[model samples]
Target chain A: MEVLRLQQQLIELTNSLFQEGFLDDQFTQLQMLQDANNPDFIQEVVTLFAEDSERILAELTKTLETEPIDFKRIDAYVHQFKGSSSSIGAQRVKAVCVDFRAYAETENREGCCQALQQIKQEFFLIKSKLEALLQLEQQILAAGGSLPVME
Target chain B: MENVDGDESQPGREETGNLQNLLCGKKILVVDDNRVNRIVAAGALKKYGAHVECADSGKAAIAKLEPPHTFDACFMDIQMPEMDGFEATCNIRKLEEIAKESGKIWHVPILAMTADVIQATYDECVWCKMDGYVSQPIEEEQLYKAVSQVLSRT
Candidate 1:
């Protein structure tokens, strides 16, 4: 009964994430790759995404704060961020990064700063939701229940 | 009692299993400067039963190609601080040439792993003599297909 309850919670949370545009088909593709041998695959990837995103965000903030801003370097950082976000299926974060790169390309200081803030907000929002979903998965697994698969 | 056979029938399991079989006992090197990317790539490769090694830079990757360390293939990331993937592949080809001259005859396949999915980027990889290409956020099937294709050429 506990397992069923937790599974329901996970399913609901996952649905909400998709409905909210925080994720997309890529996330589903990611989940499809997980298996009994690599049970913690999603969690591992998400953890890496979180760590890499935070570091890139910090570097971006510092880069934008400097005088005679180096748009090339900023673009490089944003490119890395886009790769990581896209890899993990953070659609919203990846979208913001695309916008960020456009600003970087034009050397638009104000636009770059705005994109950074938007990226940060989207990244944090998804990160928290993913963490919550992962926690629910843990509970279900602890109770010897398998994760609910979405079609 | 709830039937838990769902996990067994999850999508991509069969393909993943076949790929794992193809990679079993293979010696592969994962070259990347980022710790997270290294971990993710290595973890996925290791799961497929490959003996995976890590090189944080292109120079280190070249060094590892020398005596006492041999690999069947390498997954090289495109961007790094000192030497990027293009330079690295060129250097690796040089090493291969030297080995061939010495009668060692090593033809290790090197795959370019990157997020840049433009036609120009792929053309650049081919120009650098990389055996194949795999994009970032490496998926199991993509990794398997790339490695398989490269190994087939050798």
Candidate 2:
């Protein structure tokens, strides 16, 4: 009785994510890349984005106090962070980088500091959403079902 | 001039001024849960000669309306707590319909501002059919162009 309800719930969660724009076609593509061959591929990648972005943010923070605001160093970090966020289809974080670079170009230390805060706020949001999606994947598996195809 | 605060290169003030021309005289709304972004964004928009307003989240945005109250365009930051941009966008569409009046009541363009920019990001923008987008840390020209492009057709 409950199993049917559970399946329906999983479907609903997937759809909700779609409507929310939390999961886009690329995320669907990520889901598609998985099969019995690699059940955890999407989840693994999501975790990696979560991890890598944290390190870049940390690196950027360490350099914030440099005199004249060494923008070369700062842009390098934003560039790297942009790449990682891009890889996982984290649209928001990468977008933040576009503005972040402008802040660096202007040597706006305060702007850069503020940008860092925005980046952190958005980075963790993607992390949690992907984590939730991964949990849903687990639920589908536990329910004696295959991964849901994102249409 | 009245609104700018944290920008460096006071000498580059001219450069910033050229950048501001992108949104010249435009009416804009900056939606973000963060106050700092609100301040920075409003300042940027004002530099471009834009009239700007700020809202913390989707809910606050929905509740905000001063008569003759309409922006030529809106910049919405996704991932806000309480009510995120996607839901807010959808809801704003509804509100616009209810608040509709003559003299260009058809559409109000909303430019999505986000820190994440990926294929997923593009897909979401498409899915939402947003009028425009400017990624976070927000470039002066890019932000202005996105707003201008959306506003021009309207």
Report lDDT per candidate: 0.80, 0.66
Show how many residue pairs clash in every candidate, following the order shown: 0, 17
| Residue-level lDDT tens digits of model 2 in B8-75 | 31225554565555567767788876553454456546645778888888887766632246677788
TM-score of each: 0.86, 0.47
Residue B125 displacement (Å), model 1: 2.4
Worst 10 residues of 1 chain B by lDDT: B1-10
Model 2 chain B TM at 0.75
List the RMSD of every prediction in angstroms.
5.7, 19.4
- Model 1, A77-101: lDDT tens digits are 8877876677677778888988898
Candidate 1 lDDT score relative to the true structure: 0.80
Judged by DockQ cut-offs, the docking class of candidate 2 is: incorrect
Instruction: Kindly report the docking quality category of candidate 1.
Output: acceptable
Q: After superposition, how far is residue A58 of candidate 2 from its true place, in Å?
A: 1.1
TM-score of the second chain, each candidate in turn, equals: 0.85, 0.75
Q: Pick the candidate with the highest lDDT.
A: 1
Query: What tens digits encode model 1's per-residue C-alpha lDDT throughout B1-154?
Result: 0111223333387777777777788899999887667766777677778888999999999899763356888999888778998898898888788778877777678888886666326679778888888877676666767877876554
> Which regions of candidate 1 fall more than 4 Å away from where they truly are?
B1-18, B119-122, B139-145
